[model samples]
Target: MRSNIYIGSKRRLSIIALGLIIFLFTTGIAHAQTVDGNKYQLTLAEAIRFAKSQNKLVQVATLEESAAKEDRKDAYNAALPAITANGSYQRFSQLTLFTDGLSHSTTGPRKPSANGAALGIDALFNIYSGGKQRALQDEQQSRVHLARLNTLDQSGSIALQTAHQYLELVRLNDLQKLILDQLNRAQTRLNNINSLYKNQKVTKSDVLRAEVVLSNVQLSLQENENDLTITNRKLDVLLNIPDSVRIAPVDSAGMPKPAIDSLLPFIESAGVTAYSVQKIKENIELQKARVKGVESSNKPSIGFYTAYGLNYPNYLFFPPVNQAYAIGFVGLKAQYSISSLYHNKSKVAAAKLRERELEVQQQANNDNVRTEASSYYIKYTEALTRIAVNERSVEQAQVNYRIVNTKYLNQLSLLTDLLDADNLYQESRFNMIRAQTNALNIYYNILYISGNL
Candidate 1:
């Protein structure tokens, strides 16, 4: 009876232990999630969105665009009339008295006090500025357009970077899994060889060789894990997420099939209008506008001005003294500056030179875009061919590994042959991964360089 009670107690203790372990494991997972801030199932679209929102480069570019808009607005407002108000007050220590020399008597000053105040409003309307205002408006418009394009360019660049990093993280994750699988196979083989050596069916050297292979596989696994960690960190930084958070990508989709037929057409269409190319072209226009503005500066400007003022102790003869009165004036005017004329020739020459330089740069940039697109296309095709070839190689390697593995089991093949075949199979798989990833990267690069991304 006592023995039965002890057995029941033992069973209850085991059950309690299992429950504790379960509780600890569940809580551990929760703690990991909590420490990492939040778990995000990041997708390509989501990554791009996050980068656009959080990237400092994109933010700065947006601000520049806004500033350019304000500049354009100011330029537009320059064509409107300007109005200003003025006021002044003065207090004298003593009043001035006019004396009659013949009578030797001083007539009392008309004003009761030595203090005075005046207020005025002045208005000016620019009738003409020799087209300088129009030129300025055009230049400002070009700047605004350039700023907008630059913002788009910045966004495209950030998106491309995010895609590259995300793809690399995915590739590293796949590679780590592959290496872990290899390590597992090596460990299983090592165990088999150890048993065979103990039974005297295999030599001690065989066991040592197997152990060495297992250690190498383990080292490879460790290196791959480290690589995964670093790649994850890079992606986290790009997404502006916490580094401690572990990302498990659920999108295991491999490289997409390329639409070869449309790729060249898309590149050609997007190449001409690329933001970089367009910005340079617009800069040329801006410089031309500056030349016009410089020429306009040497010409004359016509305007109209009007002013009305009220003053205490009116000094006008028509207005009675010792009283506040109003004075008004209106006039048309024309003015020319010889200072700008002195430098106009040089300024125009400099502006033309800058415009020409920009044209040359624009042409060069267009050529570069074409070249980059062509090169990326070639790389993508090569990757496709490599994928096909490596896929065949993997098939062949798999068959060879199976045959060698069977032969080794039957003692009809050397362990070296089996190990070599296994290594070949693993290498072929890695090659396939490389081919696929390279193809994906190059295709996206083509899109990026074309400014279509």
Candidate 2:
């Protein structure tokens, strides 16, 4: 009875130890999962927003826009009156006159005033410049618009690039999962072959083949891991994040998939709304304004000018005077560049030529955008079709693999048949994933071309 009681206590202790180990293992796994979940996760929209704000190209474009705004301000300031102040002081030395040569007088020397001081203010208001100032203002305004359009273009380009890399990473992750699953199956197959070989049911060659296949799957997994790391780093650069941090996309399923009811709207929108097209249109306006400015040089410029000042030892009088005197004058000023009459013709012609060139460029850009939009629309539709086809292929390949695997296990088929079916199965799955990602990518491309992204 004592021996039975001791055995019961020992069994109870063993049960408690087992329970403790299980609890600790589960807790550790949960903790690891929590840590993984805490890692930085980003959605596509968040990434695009971050990139637009932080990307070097976008920042450069924004700076250019700011500079253009400053230029506009300068142009406006040119139309305002210009005022200037001046002040000066000087000590005069004694002056001697040669009275003996002209007057034949014995007076030795005469001194002018001891010192002189002057304070003055001048103002010039441009009342007319043959419309040159107004034209320049218009040109600067167009430049501001162009710069802003360039910034928008840069932002859109970066967003598209970010989406590409982000989707590539997501695709790689999905492929990794598939490859890992295949690796396990390969390992199981190798083990099964080894077991059969030990029973003398399979040849040594069969075992070697299974090992090679398993090795190949492992190699694929390694290659995929390398690609994942590289893609993650690229995305980090785009996001302006630290290279050491790895980013995982939160979800790609939320990407827009607009219906393809009509392609005409996209094409039309791209021709008018795309940043490139808008920039060209602004450039044409800028060139026209420049032409007007060049032509204005041939005409006269008229302005109002005024000056007022106080002077000591005033030199305006014939004899030197010691007392301070106030002086003031106001008049209208006109200027005409005789050389510009001949020289400005060539400049105006050149400016007009540039304007025409921009108009031609605008036409070309419109055509290109329309073509691009139409092409992407077709590709987007094609990708949807391919997705359906690949889905069916995956189903067929999965069924074929199961049949071949069962046949090999029952010793009714060669190992090569099983391996081929397995490879086909993996390829089909890979194709399916590629098709899905390609569809999403094409959708984004369409949006980008249409300036809607």
Question: Which candidate wins on lDDT?
Answer: 2
Segments in model 2 whose C-alpha atoms lie over 4 Å from true places? 1-38, 98-111, 252-256, 262-264
lDDT string, candidate 2, 1-453, tens digits: 999998997776556434433433554422211114223556666667667777888889999999999999999999898999999998766554556587653443334566778999999999999999999999999999989888898999999999899889878988999999999999999999999999998999999999988999999999999999999989878866556556667655324456776545776689898878888898899988989889999999999999999888667777876578888899999999999978888888888888899999999989988888888888888988888799899999999999999998899999989999999999999998888888888877877788877
Candidate 1 residues 65-104, lDDT tens each? 9999999999999999899999999885643454675555
The per-prediction tally of clashing pairs is 0, 0
lDDT values of the candidates?
0.78, 0.83
Worst 10 residues of 2 by lDDT: 29-38
Clashing pairs in 2: none
Clashes of 1: 0
The C-alpha RMSD of each candidate to the native structure, in angstroms, is 10.8, 12.4
State how far residue 158 of model 2 sits from its true place (Å). 0.6
